[model samples]
Target: MPMTSTPTPAMAKQTPKQPPTPTAKATKATPTRKRPKLCPPDVTDRRRRPAGRIAPEALAAERGSALEGLDWLGRPPEATASLLYRLLRLVARFIIFVVFRFRIRTSGQENIPAGGYFLVAAAHRGWMDPFLVMQALPSQPRCWFLGSAPSTFTSRWRERLIHRLGGLLPVWRGGVGIDQHVASARAVIANGAVFAQMPEGTVSGPAGLIGPFRTGWAVIALRVDAPIVPLAIAGTEELYLGRRMVSRVLPVTSARALAGLDHGAEMPPPGTREELDVARRMSDALAAIIGPVVESIHPRTVDPVEHPRRFRRRLTWLFLRPGRLDRDG
Candidate 1:
């Protein structure tokens, strides 16, 4: 019973079990194919293209597009009449500085770029504010203004004269022809001229009080890729009364910041709530910058809190009527 049992005959017939066949050495996994890198549209072609080479059709299309859009007063004539322009500017400046006896204090003339497009905006309370802003810039770059159409174009002769000056753009209120005006501004700025607009849209508001700013300036600034300069041209409120006008061209703010806007965003139509909100934000930013300067210039006269509201209400009513708000004489 204690003896081990012998294997069966069938088991004996079977050969001693051999070690299990070793699996063929596992082959390393084949590497996966990598995706090709994507190139930018400009470099999509593998062949190196010559620099500045553009298709004739593309160039022609661009040229044709440029010629279209609302007609600007005219192409900037700075190069053809640089001297004459400067001379005329000087004479006009002299009249403003001497005859008007404006104080003409400026803060950031250096902020004005020597060339290229930019927007100079101010709290407009009178016709002279735009002119003062123009003269205040030490650079004195060729500038176009977005002025009220009815006021500036009162006569054909007046229109011709303003158009000849090379920076006069007329804007209609109550959202009429705004697209054309904005397009015109784009064209002027695209041509490398300075564009200036009174964010307040008119000169009827109280002095030193910033009224509700219009959205057109933001639209132009954003679309034109121009930096907005919040210029403070105070004291013009008393210009006719013999008080000196003090104006300062403040530091430049990116249009995006001033308007709280981004490039290429569809502009809300003029006078709409969305547009007004954008304008109000821009005005707030500008007011923050120029409020102190305005106060220092005309501390006793500034009643921003009460006066601007009343003026705006009156303006809202006038703006709703059939005729233009006649410009200050």
Candidate 2:
């Protein structure tokens, strides 16, 4: 009796190896719940939780975002949906006032993607193209509209508005300021926003053939290793019923995004002999999409574009740098 001992129930129940970690017990004891996604809006609306904690089943009855007034006009959506709507409407004002009267239609809108940053290039046909392209766009993958090249005539309010809407970028008017521009464009792309530019330089006006292709666009694309999307719009002059027919013409033309390859270092430098050759090929590629209409369609006739003071100042450093020659005795 003295030697006999009853086995303890606790000892019989335990048969483990190593000790458990502190976090292991905590994790095992707690149940994890998934978080709700707050990305872009969905195709369909889900019901709102009543009492701020609606059951999953209650989601069927909730209303989504509201669009009252012209609040939804802004482009380049903000973190908040309501804000995005407002920005979208703001961008639309240009179209409503100017482009709609021209009947500027947008064709090949299917070409524009729904999201992310890109390098958007359009053949400069008329001053009207930027307004038409920006306003009539079907989608803005988080638009960051770059303003026109520095012009002396731009109003302060207009400048402020362009920047406020995230539409401000400098463009070199002529010659080969390609490398310098690529630096500026790189900043935009790096920031995860779109960089929009007109490769045609100033408006085509009624005169001047579409001019030779500018290599700066290709250079920037290759430098950033970004896709170069060519935008071809026609009918600004042809469709201009002064201010009425702009609506019809707005929808015409085509847009193509050449996401082919990075075009990286493999591509020639802009303005170089090699670059010129490549740019010509790109121009031809765009021409194929636009066809004969562009050849015959004249630019919306307008006065020559003038550079603004601020732009001229910035460009002075890049463009007006005279070569300093050392005169030796």
Candidate 3:
């Protein structure tokens, strides 16, 4: 055999490599894990949130007690003029006359209806303005006031005293207890008495400046079909002895007429856009009527230098509660 040789040791160990076969475990699909949904924090968690963030029902219930411990609104309209009311009015008048020596002057007394329900809308400048208006009006049908509960009832004694006097209809600010307030006001009007309110809502800046009027008065007047007797008070902003306080009653007008709506026309449902528009127009008309009167009596801007020297500075703080004496204007 021509050149046939024996294989080497390295050639015997060498072989061709091949791909491995696939198995069932390698072809299977992996499962996906689902995540949990997120949610808002609980309002009842007192430690984590503020106390004011309570439920609507809880808030209403809390605010409904604003007039609690007072029996004024529970009485019949005719019976609302209790003896305490007359006595308190007399005492207030005595203080105004003898203690303060304030000269009371009134104009357009004839504008006030002799015997009927009416609304007295006035610009509020000070705590004493309400008492001044009460003094100016006749005492027959007692006047009921829609007062801010927090401002009026600052203490237990004040709350008790005001409750005993029996003429205030407590209303909380920020729209709490609004329905009850409207109902009480309507009751006062239906009782054939005067309902006095400050259209500016709270004491605005010094005596002469009138703040923007709110629509509550206009809305209530329209709903009750009562005439509004605009009252412009002057000289109570800054108080001193021998001050001349004037209560001028403007012409009596109806909210419906002021809003340019037909007399006795049905009002849109409460809180509706149409109703709001009507109230706004009525409030604007009211402001137009009363603005000039107030400005004429009291200058728009008062200089501190022109203020009369108060011998006893405490006299200026007479109407303000002790708690508010230190507060700045």
Candidate 4:
């Protein structure tokens, strides 16, 4: 039996295989592309090519069209609303602030730049809130207000008046119109124009009560990198008593600067829900900052919460309205 066994091949002769290690070439990653700048159309227009084959008049028209681009506000012709527009603006201001004696208590008035696309926010109390909002500018930076459509404006004349007022961004409520609204806001902001909004939208329901503010302001501020200015209006309700309310230029942005908002943490990435949340927080923060200052100007009513400084009829012989007037005055 021992002689019959044949020798088997040696196990030592077989090679053990090793797993492959990755080489630098085999594991290379793809490079990333940079994002394009999100500048306004006006800025973009500076680089467009001129038309080569049009007649002089036609070329002029074509050239204007090409150069009138704005990242936001659509191409507007060089025309503005009629002179009647200016007169009406003058009359409106005269009636509300001057003849009526609606006093404006402005603080920190030096902060606002004379012009630029910035975001301005303030408390909402009445339909006249817009008037108050405008009258109180540090320097009159024409604002683009996001509002209902021209049809919603109802009155044709009023619609024309609004457009003439400058920067009235129209958005259709509850439908396709919001396109115009967002577009208008985006255009003005991209172009370095001012856009003021009552983040709370609409005249507030009543005094001492405010509705849930919409996130539109946050959206625009975040997307456009525009400065946000929080404002507080106290004597407005009182103005309705004897005259229309007049606005005042408060140093809100400056106040924020004085309050040190400028040096705070970098704002969250703009154009995200996070940006909106920041806007909400900002609204709350500004409200907190101004609440005390406002309280001192107009005390709240215990029986029913008050709205700013409301003046009422004095029972005195000379101050009564209508039939209550003394027959022998």
Candidate 4: count of backbone clashes, pairs at least 3 residues apart or interchain: 14
Q: Which tens-of-lDDT digit does each residue in 151-201 have in candidate 1?
A: 455456865666666666655333444566567666666666676777666
Which digits, one per residue and each the tens of the lDDT, describe model 2 over residues 37-82? Answer: 6665453456653333332122212323321111222333232224
Residue lDDT tens for model 3, 1-329? 69978778777667555688676576556877778565555644436432233332343365566442123456655534667777777887888889777777778888888645555556576677877777667887877788766556556688678666666777644344356666776777777777777877766555665678888777777667677788887766666766666778887888777898787688768767887788899888888888778778665323356656554346655544544322221
Q: Which candidate's lDDT is highest?
A: 3
Give the whole-model CA lDDT for all candidates, comma-separated.
0.58, 0.43, 0.67, 0.47
Order of the predicted models by lDDT, top scorer first: 3, 1, 4, 2
Tens digit of lDDT per residue, candidate 4, span 108-132? 5566665554545445544455556
Clash totals for all models, in order?
1, 39, 0, 14
The TM-score values for the models, in the order shown, are 0.60, 0.49, 0.71, 0.53
State the displacement of the C-alpha of residue 126, model 4, in Å, after optimal TM-score superposition: 1.9
Q: Which ranges of candidate 4 are over 4 A from the true structure?
A: 1-85, 97-101, 138-140, 149-152, 174-182, 206-211, 237-276, 300-329
Tell me how far the alpha carbon of residue 255 in candidate 2 is from the true structure, in angstroms, after superposition. 15
Candidate 3 yields a Cα-based lDDT of 0.67
17: Cα error in model 2, Å:
99
Alpha carbon RMSD to native, model 1: 23.2
Q: Which of candidates 2 and 3 reaches a greater TM-score? A: 3
Question: Model 1, residue 231: what's the lDDT?
Answer: 73
